[model samples]
Target chain A: MTPHDDTQQAQTRAAQEPIAISERELTVMTAHLEEAHQATLPVMHDAIADWDERLRSENDPAELAEMRARFGRPSRRGFLIGAGATLGGLVLAACSSSDGKKSSGPATTNTKAAAGGGLATDLKIAALAAALENTAVATYQAGINAATAGKLGTVPPAIVTFATTVQQQHKDHAAAWNAIITGAGKPAVTGVDTTVNDGVVQPAFAQVTDVAGLAKLALSLEDAAGATYLSVIPVVSDPGGVKTVATIQPVEMQHAAILNFVLGQYPVPNAFAKTDGARTLTDKIG
Target chain B: MTIDEQELAELTSRSRDVHNDAMRETREPLSEIVEVGREHRAHDEIDPLAGREFAKQRNLQLGKRVGLLGGVGIGAALLGLFDQPAFADKPSDIQMLQTSASIEVLAIAAYTAVLGLPFAGSLPAVVQTFVTTTKDQHMQHLQAFNAAATALGGKAQSMADPVLAKVVEAAKPGLTGPGPVLDLAIELENTAAETYVANTGALEDENAKKVTASIMGVEAQHVSVLLAVQALLSGGLVDQIALPPPNLSALPAAAGGVGFPNAFYKTDLARAADEGAVK
Candidate 1:
């Protein structure tokens, strides 16, 4: 059989099999989610505290009460429900039997396909993001290597240093995604998808021989990366996953803004960053 | 529970009166308010049981004076109450938009005031342009937010608040040169960014969360650019842009002075106070 046919058959076989997640795996996933949720609380609490102090200092008891009621404290209920649903969904997805027989209470056969669909979607998205990061790491490394070889003609030393730092950040982002996949009991994608590298990164790299060209390319890449993250966030089911995606998105925007300045463009270009050109690596590759 | 004609008429009258009062306070047209009220009435009719359930959910225990409008359905009265600027007992989506709009107004005013400074004239052309561009962006954001708030049957807040103005005035003495002015801009952008970030988590509507996230991204960009300018003016190389340390102990000497200075952007009050964005 051809490779495409073989892949399709494999997918069909995987879907037909009864999937299961161990209790230990569930515990590990829950722990990761709880840790992420805890990390976000302090940031939120700090904002609420500032508002409280401002209202208190104003001596407006009414407004102070209102502020207190508005953002009292971070509720763990939403996080717990969200995390539970995420784990439950994944578990249900995996435990789904192809025979269409109903499972016992609290785990229905009806939700099996839907939950599995969601988990699959999340995995695909994570893979796409990881692939993009791999491409970014490769791109930056290429630039860095060229600079070291004194072949990045007319590129400023500052831009080279910035590239080195950003390269490491992309590496961290890639590693984070791989960890998420591995933690979910999926095989981690280790390298940049060749199609993405060829279609997007390679074309951009081919056009940039000097500092200005590299800055322009970097701006485009960063903008696309930021836009993709923002777009994917709402679709991601896990709140912890949303937070992880959000944590990295702003840094990409930061990189883009700095590059814009390097290109003599306005740094803060818009009040709302546009996600006009957002595309997953899968989309590009496909 | 079909027809109570007298009670229904009384409810409609009370609704119009309360809505008119809101209109007078906000100086917005009454047609929009009436339209929103009609929409709520339709919703109540569609889900009559939900009206009583919603009322029970609120468990409003206020005095009789602030109670339901002459025995009107709690849902209908609550809808009317939502339009009122004074009734902030419960926070909702529109209130969040208004709060964000108010901050955007403050940003515009702060930028305008900074541009008026004598030192502003001596700054580079690019810096002046940056200030103007950022102020215009804030104005655009304010307009979008105000429109959203008004469309939701709520009053749009003023573009300037005396309270926020006083806060700005308190910081005026520190605006000695371009460096300090840029620092002030950085502080404002940081708060704005954090506020937007915090709201994204708080907002119930998914669209609102996404829109707020988009705004937060731009706000971070503003902070990044401002910090870069601040660094360049201080005779630091552009390569000095380093990531904020993950641990507080490893913080650089000029903590909060660099763009993206924190590994994770904090949305807490303590950080805002430390950053001097608030009192």
Candidate 2:
């Protein structure tokens, strides 16, 4: 045989040579791996437990409560008194006002009853939702800024087309949400550091400096917004408004799915679970 | 009162279906929200794929795509090693890294948010592992960011907010059921992974981008594990895999003008304000 033929034969023989790992042994190995995997989780619980301990021991309940009030439930307390008086007054004022331009303000007479005798908490949720909508609005604006800064002899047609489309969606959502907040007599959630922690917003844009990245960020933010709405919907007093928020959820899910697909990643299923690992679209492959 | 068997089973079924649906379909509903939401906007002006014009013009380029596009021969030659001097011109690298670190902190908060849920007390072993390790990964990511930043002459960050505190509160055992916690974890990890992968192209040092890519990989694994655990706790199959299936980028246009025509949108904030989705 020629040298090439001999080498080829040897390579083929090596490829077929698998004599070890009986079925029983393989099952044991798989079980062991799964066991290890299962066992590795408790360590996480312990850490969370430790965190809970620290929170319970060190955090002043009063101060925590206050913070929760300011950040989490600011409008809830005010809502009980605020809703009845404001909705009637605003609706009248809006009706009397000849300007077809309705109150884009948070107190816009659009009352969606809360899930459990809807109170101020719905307003807070709505405010946060509006805030999120605003953030999304800002993100698309930033995308335009990024594109503008990188002025081109001829910008990529795809980038131009997609960016504009996504931007319009964010704007519309923000406007729609703003109208909701205003009709309720709540202050419109203006764009002032809508990034969750009041951290810089532009850098988030900078980090994901590609069209796909921008799309993904939009999807992520939209998903978070959807979750916020879902979590809040059941608690709102107005079932109709709850229906509106609920309607919004599946749409946000679709946005995330589309963005995930664009980035060569997959969309997640659960809208409410914040920790589902389905968000890691890029990490699963090579 | 604890969630009953029927309730728990329902949660399990829903979570499984959501996971399954995501795996099966290229397009779900969220994109439509964004697409419908931004119908009036313009496009992002910069095209990342334009290679030499849009990207390399910035400064010393070291990302994988940069290497591939600048010159195949040159890129291939420098495949294994990164040139540090090339990164000297860009200060924004530090800013982006810090942004990533901040995101990591946000993740830690989200994963731990379950602590406040009423049912956190009796988390199954698998669910607990999924949550804790995911948090650990976030912590590790924070540390990695710090280490990488320090290596590059940037200081570690120290920003705190009520959001992180709230997340920790949410993570308290027996505070709530596992479903919500899993949901939050998924959202944060997806954001982080997408953010990192997107930035992979911008890093001037190919090595740094590689580091970012590796973190994205880990984050993705975290996603899969979390999905499985949620599925399992809700009584899903142990071997079930939850991924994005077809990535979000490739989805076709939504019917009746619902989803985005493309991913990026470029309208001004003022115009967006006019659109009424935000105030």
Model-by-model DockQ, in order: 0.11, 0.04
lDDT of 2 by residue, A1-286 (tens): 4323433443343234332213233234334534533342342233224333433444455544532443331221112111221111111111232332211111122222211123344444545555555556556556555555452222233234344445455555555555555544334555322233133344555576566566666666665554454334334443334434433443354455445534434233232233222111000000
Clashes of 1: 7
Tell me the whole-model lDDT of each prediction, alpha carbons only.
0.52, 0.40
Tens digits of lDDT, candidate 1, B129-233: 567767876776676556655554456766553334455667789888887787668767766776666555554445545556667777788888786566555
User: How much DockQ does model 2 earn?
Assistant: 0.04
